[model samples]
Target: MSAPVIAIDAMGGDFGPHCIVPASLACLAEIPSLHLALVGQTPLIEKLIDRQPGVDRARLQIVHASEVVAMSDRPAQALRGKPDASMRVALEMVRQGRAQACVSAGNTGALMALSRYVLKTLPGIDRPAMMAALPTRAGSCHLLDLGANVDCNAEHLYQFAVMGSVAAETLGVRRPRVALLNVGTEEIKGNQQVKLAASLLRQAPGLNFIGFIEGDGVYRGDADVVVCDGFVGNILLKSSEGLAEMVAEKIRDLFSRNLASRLLGAVALPLLRSLREELKPATHNGASFLGLQGVVVKSHGGAAEDAFQSAIRRALVEIHENLPQRLHGRLEDLLL
Candidate 1:
């Protein structure tokens, strides 16, 4: 079979093609069966490609899009104004079956809005959710509703749990332990909505429903999947990212403090490098807008080349696993 074609919004991120072109070439070098459509202004993309020698022209093409969705643009404004934006064009490619998946590091709200408009939700999915994997003691755990449906109901949270389970399984977890993010582990420790959601999750068929997981439990790998409303999920995502940055900065400061510390740092360089690589948010950059009809991975707008590459790989994985199809089946089975 032919390789899956991924349509990328080359001009979407803060650095645009400066970061995307190199990452595309890197991914193509490693993945033999991957084709890429870099959608953006033709001249800019061609210029970057020209600077990079030996790109397989046959496997990579530039699709011109006249407009771009700015990082500062509101979701509603973007949808109405930037009809020819690279982000929308990439989604159109997926809608027309020109690409197996689409990846972007554009405006999060705009990306999510355009995706739902272009791809629609699966049969059983009332609203889509955004999810990503975070490094945990047990390797990694999938966390859902990262920022998609900010105001979700108990049923929505329940659906998130199901979708998160499917995603965790696709990432190689079998019978993932799904849990609701709560203030306390006890059944009655949360708000009415969370308490109600927990009740629904416990009775949810085919879900390995673990009772509740506090915020700290998220890193302890207490559950393979953690489900929460987008409001809370977004806060958690941002806070975790901030904390990671703070810790890395502290480590650097500690190492550069004095001659003795510098000597110790030199000796511990290899171990510190390994730890940094494991903890870097860039390594886990992409977040999937789950429950949509097609595969769409969202890269951080400020991502560098390596981080963008991580997002592309994420899209590839979802495409290979036929995530949407599998998620549909799982939802149907759970509902029945």
Candidate 2:
């Protein structure tokens, strides 16, 4: 059977045509019977298509968008001024049933904001969280509200646990472990918000709550789901990113110091590659803006072609899995 179609925001990321074009081509090659609605300037997308060798030009169509939302623009203002933006057009395609899902490596804040304004949240889901799977020393762990709603309440966090739990189920984990990010593991050890959230989650039926998870809990691999509001979560995400970058830089520096270091590096190439594979953020390029009516993946700003391809592939799996329908079924239980 043919796979469902997807809409791609062709003009969103730092690299724009350079990254998006190759990524879409890669996606088309991998996903048989997949169709794409290229949401951007029609002529630009056409020009890119014309240059590719042995391309199945019929599989792609251009949906012209007039404006582009800048990475620096405020979400509210950008949405108001750029109604015909590439991201907006891509989302509209999903809304109109012309596409199964929408993927973009663009303005994350704008994407989350517009998705909320355009798609709205499901019942009992007041705020949608930007959830990402972080690569850990043990394995990959889930972190919610990476940079979406900065200030969230205890109830919002509880809801995130529910949504995150559903995500774990879709990802094939049974009875997923849930943990609240706090300063302490004690039930009353956190701020008033976290304290209240702890009580709620503890009492929340259906969720496999494992109590409070501190910052150290993340690296310790103590929980499957790490829960926090956007502000705190964003900080944690950036902190992890910064540390990863630092470690990679340090490794490179160590390997570049004259003949002895070079020889050591050459001898350990396979080991280093294995470590890189485990540490690569781009291994999972797309993260969903969960709680929307349909699947929406947001890629990294500087995502390379490989990262973009990985993201599109992830979108395909999410679409095929019918995550939304399943999530809806699990909603009442999620709403505690």
Candidate 3:
């Protein structure tokens, strides 16, 4: 079999090709069989490519895209206006079967809209939920609708639950425990939509619904999958990211306070480094747009080189697992 090829939106993110080029180099070095198609303005991408000496050019190819979808552009505007945008071009490669997956640290809305437009939803899927890996005490949990369907109904949330369950299984959990994010654990808690969704999940045959999980319970390793509407999920994701940054900063401040503290920090440096690594958002930067026919990974727009590499790694996993195909089969079995 030929090596897996990933299409990357080279000019998509805040740092653009500056970060992506180095990340691509690292990925290529780490995974020998991986090929990368960096789609964007040729000149800019070439400039970064020129910076890396003795790199294997054969495994890396650049597909030129004239326009770019800015982070500030509305999804509708981007969809209509920038037909040649880097993000669009990358997804196009996936649609054409030129690449197994597409990775973009671009505008989330534009990526989702363009991906849906290009790849379409999987059979039986009404909409694709933005699913991502969230750090938890029990290793990691899959959270869905990170910001895709803001006004989801019970049926939509139910679909997210089903997709999340499949995703968790793909990520190595068998018969993953699923939960709905709510204000309380009681069946009576939450709005009508959540309550109704919970009812549907409970009635889902073969689904291991573990009841409701509050915001406080999310990181406590309570469940393998946490399902919620995009609005709530987005808020939780950003809030947790901000809180992790704050806590890490506070630890740095605490360690730098005085000579004695500095000495203590030296003694505990390795442990502190490990803890910091666990808390960093970059380590868990990629979000999978589940329920789509093609594999699409959304990297943080402000991601650094290492973070972008992480997103590429994520796309590799999904591609190798043939996640979309597996998910389609699972959806067929459960929903049909």
Model 1 poorest 10 in a row by lDDT:
276-285
RMSD each, Å: 1.4, 1.8, 1.4
- 189 Cα displacement, candidate 2 (Å): 1.5
- Looking at model 1, the pairs that clash are none
Please provide, for model 2 over 1-108, each residue's C-alpha lDDT reduced to its tens digit, 9 standing for 90 to 100. Answer: 365888999998999977798789878877668888788988888888888887776787788998898888899977899999999988988888788899999899
The TM-score, computed over Cα atoms with residue i paired to residue i, of candidate 3 is 0.96
Off by over 4 Å in 2: 280-284, 334-336
- Looking at model 3, the pairs that clash are none
Task: Report the C-alpha lDDT of model 3 over 1-336, residue by residue, as the tens digit.
Answer: 478899999987898888888898889888888999999999998988888887788999999999999999999989999999999999999999999999999999999999999999998999999988787887878888899989999999999999999888887898999999999998789999999999889889888999999987888989989999999998988888788888777887888899999888778776777766666553457889999989999998988888888899889989989999989988888788
Overlapping backbone residue pairs in candidate 3 total 0
Q: How far does residue 295 in candidate 1 sit from its true spot (Å)?
A: 0.2
lDDT of 1 by residue, 20-120 (tens): 88898889888888999999999988988888888898899789999999999999988898899999999999999999899999999999999988899
lDDT, ranked from best to worst? 3, 1, 2
